[model samples]
Target: LPSAGSSRFAAAVTQHAPAFKGTAVVNGEFKELSLDDFKGKYLVLFFYPLDFTFVCPTEIVAFSNKANEFRDVNCEVVAVSVDSHFSHLAWINTPRKSGGLGKMNIPVLSDLTKQISRDYGVLLEGPGIALR
Candidate 1:
């Protein structure tokens, strides 16, 4: 993973995904998670721009609402952003009508260091956030 402000970025995730481990908010609880946790299953790893946003919430909640469907097919859904875990929890606690992520069924991770975003080729290096 790229260090903070590292120049090595935007190389694209051409090979296997760069492994990552970090704090995540899952079902309104904090947990330690890593890419390895979803082993033996199809992993839908998605990266968003921030915790509190307009379009971002829709995508997060849509995937979250459809989490069971993914699980039925033996897959796991995980969302990542450059925001802190606290922010993710707060968003989950908020209602969807208010533009919060609301009751996330999938795990939402905190990429405060932005390493995951960087490794995935979604990091906006200038602003230090994910692209999608």
Candidate 2:
């Protein structure tokens, strides 16, 4: 999956973003997150290749660190990957020194079944991983 019609990073083709709801790790705990939960607000949704990777950690950390700034602008940042929530939590627990996302402020949704990634048009059929 690359994008529904023309969604790119912060731009778009359609006004409506794909609908999704799933288990997400928020503040070190598992919680249900959905597009409806952020209804009426600008959403900054990004999909990374996977957790525990080089660029992935940097991207997640950057988004997490800027969560407040995003909130001030009435936007909620969300990161999604094909990994499970448990994998996300483990990666979050791992320190940056060890090449993992120390912690994340935003909800990290798990697209374990790859459905979410597909919906977002970022899943690679061959590798079964989402593109960043």
Candidate 3:
């Protein structure tokens, strides 16, 4: 496994295998998406701790608020977490007033198996979670 300090890892991964195809949840719906889907378009791929949490919403909303800015730059935003697709839908359906993500215009990939997180070297082994 690569160390968290390996900044070169991301570059290496992107260089060797830049695109990944997978199933993700968007607007409370399950759909298939791929890195190729954003090809020819810049992207903002972010990771968060969990769905209904403190810092998570602040960042999610902040990104959502500025999503158009990213799009203006010909970019798309994709978020990820260890939660399942069901959990993602639940969060999306939840109201922001109750600490949920509300309706987001971006795809939130569910790394349920944690393989993606591990391959990216961001997985927190002890807790079976990933560091955002």
Candidate 4:
């Protein structure tokens, strides 16, 4: 991850994804996750600003609703946010109408350290959050 004022802050599209390890909410349970765990398969990872916020649930749910589509092409979807695993679990347990993820098929990961978001070049330094 680049520090503030670093000129190289953007992630390279064609390169391998940066290595990451963290706790993630999976099916209402917390589990350890790592980038290497998905080796040999395509990964469709995305980062959202945070959990239980505007547009975040809608986007994640839309991705979850198309789980089969990703699977059909041999890919797995993973969503990341600056929130903790507990927050992810809470949102997953809530209903969609109430700004929750609602039975998401994809795992919602917690980048609590903000390192993953920074490494991915999506962290918003001013707000201490991620950007999409």
Candidate 5:
């Protein structure tokens, strides 16, 4: 048995690190993905507020620019938000010239149910979104 606090903490960790199941934007396609997909690789899982927003693109682009660095270290960056795969693709298709992500090598996951956001403890409950 565990203390109330300890139990809550364990539950929280289990939720985030558990087997994640969803479709990810990969190589210009939305396909099924899960934590097991990254089992043999170092993963830099990050969460952002949403797509097409200020401050978010800055971080996304910055990560994009350094994507090779992570890859060099044998690590893959997987960014997530409460947006749909279509939204992620749209943002990727839009050009930086028009305030959108352009040609990013990393995959952006869609957590439309907000389950991932909540599990990661990055969700802005007030607005029912993530905080980035």
Candidate 6:
């Protein structure tokens, strides 16, 4: 992957994906994940502003519901948010009726420090939030 500061990235609309590493909630457990973990596999990664909000749960569940389809094509679906791991766990534990993304099969990473959002160039500096 090209470095975030590389000229290629500056000139190209779609540069190499930024690298990230952090803790994530997976099947009710916390796990560590990094870009390297998906080195040999195709990944469908999504970054949402936060959890338990309007539209976010729907998107998360949508991707999660079709997890099998991605696996069939050798791809892994992963999500990231600025919320903490604890928040992720709670949301997943809650049911869809409560507007929570319950029991997702994919990894939902926490970018509590916002480093991942910054590296991905999706961080809204002024608001200290990530744009989906």
Task: Assess each prediction's global lDDT (C-alpha) against the native.
Answer: 0.85, 0.85, 0.76, 0.85, 0.79, 0.85
List residue ranges in candidate 2 displaced over 4 A. Answer: 1-11
* Best model number under TM-score: 4
Candidate 1 lDDT over residue span 1-132, tens digit each: 453334454443444556889999987999999989988998888999887788899888899899999999999999999999999999899988898877888999999998888777788889998887
For the record, the alpha-carbon RMSD of candidate 3 to the native fold, in angstroms, is 3.6
Least accurate 10 contiguous residues by lDDT in model 2: 1-10
TM-score of 5: 0.84
Alpha-carbon runs more than 4 Å astray in model 4: 1-9
State the displacement of the C-alpha of residue 23, model 4, in Å, after optimal TM-score superposition. 0.6
TM-score of each: 0.88, 0.89, 0.83, 0.90, 0.84, 0.88
Backbone clashes in model 3: 0
Off by over 4 Å in 1: 1-14
Q: Model 5 over residues 15-101: C-alpha lDDT tens digits?
A: 445456777788778888887888778777788988999779989888878889998988889889999999999999999989898
Question: After best superposition, candidate 2 residue 75: deviation in angstroms?
Answer: 0.3
Q: What are the RMSDs of all candidates, in order?
A: 3.3, 3.4, 3.6, 2.8, 3.8, 2.9
Q: Which candidate order results from sorting by TM-score in descending order? A: 4, 2, 6, 1, 5, 3
Candidate 3 segments exceeding 4 Å error? 1-8, 12-18
- Please, what are the lDDT tens digits per residue for candidate 3 over residues 1-132? 244334224525444333455668876789988777887887777777777778888888788878888998898998878888888888888899998888888888888877666656667878977788
Misplaced by over 4 Å in model 5 are 1-16
Better of 4 and 5 by TM-score: 4
- Give the per-residue lDDT of model 4 (tens digit) for 30-107: 999998988888998899997778877888999999988998988999999999999899889988778777898988
Q: How many clashes show up per model?
A: 1, 4, 0, 0, 0, 0
